[model samples]
Target: MKVTEAAAQLGVSPRRVRALIADGRIRAHRVGVGWEIDGLAPSKERRALSVRSWLMLGRAVRSRALVGLSGHDRMRTAERIRRLRESDRPSRLLADWRPADAPAELYLDSLTARADRADDDYIRAALQRGPEYLRSRFDLAEVVASERAIRGESREELAERASVSARLVKNIESSQPLTSPGEVRRVLRALDIEPTALPDMVLS
Candidate 1:
């Protein structure tokens, strides 16, 4: 099938199909000026890639290499590693991967638990002040705090990176309303976190 036909079948744009081919997420061969894809082969290849991506993600997380990476870069690295793992025939398994494959959920849960612990600690501290001291608008506070902690960044260090004042970073983590919303966006960017990932209150 042609690129357009494959794109239609995959429910992705033609450009995305070309990118997948380039990334080895989809298998295709050049036929003169165009590419030829076997029917349903793309789907099978994508499924294989997904599994490989998860395996690579697990390895990266274990190594702590995923800590400071932007979400986009982390996934991209996983995909790249998957391709290398597939191509390298010297060893079937990458170093640190157990002799037996473990469920992807284990790694996912470990990462989630680490972040959750940070968020929970922040929330508990807030609750100690008073139930009424907590503001719904500051819901993003936990998110920022958790992500920053996961990245091993101090408030002062994050403020310096974001080009904001350390006091402002402290206030944001404390769930206080900021006089300048732009500072919040800056902090999020400094953490390599997308603002859209948080609650809508962040934007407001």
Candidate 2:
């Protein structure tokens, strides 16, 4: 079942269910594209300490133990805690598929352009992820740009051939991701790239 179903059974949000999975508070088995979410059984009480709660505890501990620290150290510690709390704001991953059992190491180190980090390398590394994580973070724009360069063609040249504006080509190369499937296919054809040649990293 999906995280939503498991959350429903456990009277929590899908986010909470994912949190439990990420923190290893619940036992979930990977099954193809989904998980066998039996861990959210009614008998379990999922009161795991979330990241936010952990930060809260840190703040409490800091406040209580402030007597021994120097003014400078106290300021630094307080600032660090504050920054961590701020950065811990809700994050949304821009990918087609994210697995419930993604490794904590990879998830934390990579998976950027998420939250406030612009970690393109992390995104690229994540392309080699397991079946449960199907999203490639693979940018078509990057491929198109690379191909155009190899063929010694400028954006304007490719645009003329593709019958689209150079500005559109530049947009495709930039951060604003291309969304139209038809446009994507057309661009691939212009670059002599096959749209069907996508990475086969789906959930096994």
What's each prediction's TM-score?
Answer: 0.34, 0.29
lDDT per residue for candidate 1 within 62-81, as digits (tens), equals 54344344566554644433
Estimate, for each residue in 1-204, the C-alpha lDDT of model 2 and write its tens digit. Answer: 777776655544566667678877667878886666755433333232344433332332333222333345444433332222222122222221223343344344234234235343443333221212212324444555544543546789998898887886786666344455555556667865655443332232
**TM-score of candidate 1 on Cα atoms, chains taken together:** 0.34
Task: For candidate 1, give the lDDT.
Answer: 0.54
Q: With candidate 2 superimposed using the best TM-score fit, by how many Å does residue 147's alpha carbon deviate from the native?
A: 0.4
User: How many backbone clashes can be found in candidate 1?
Assistant: 0
Error of 2 at 201 (Å): 20
lDDT of each: 0.54, 0.47
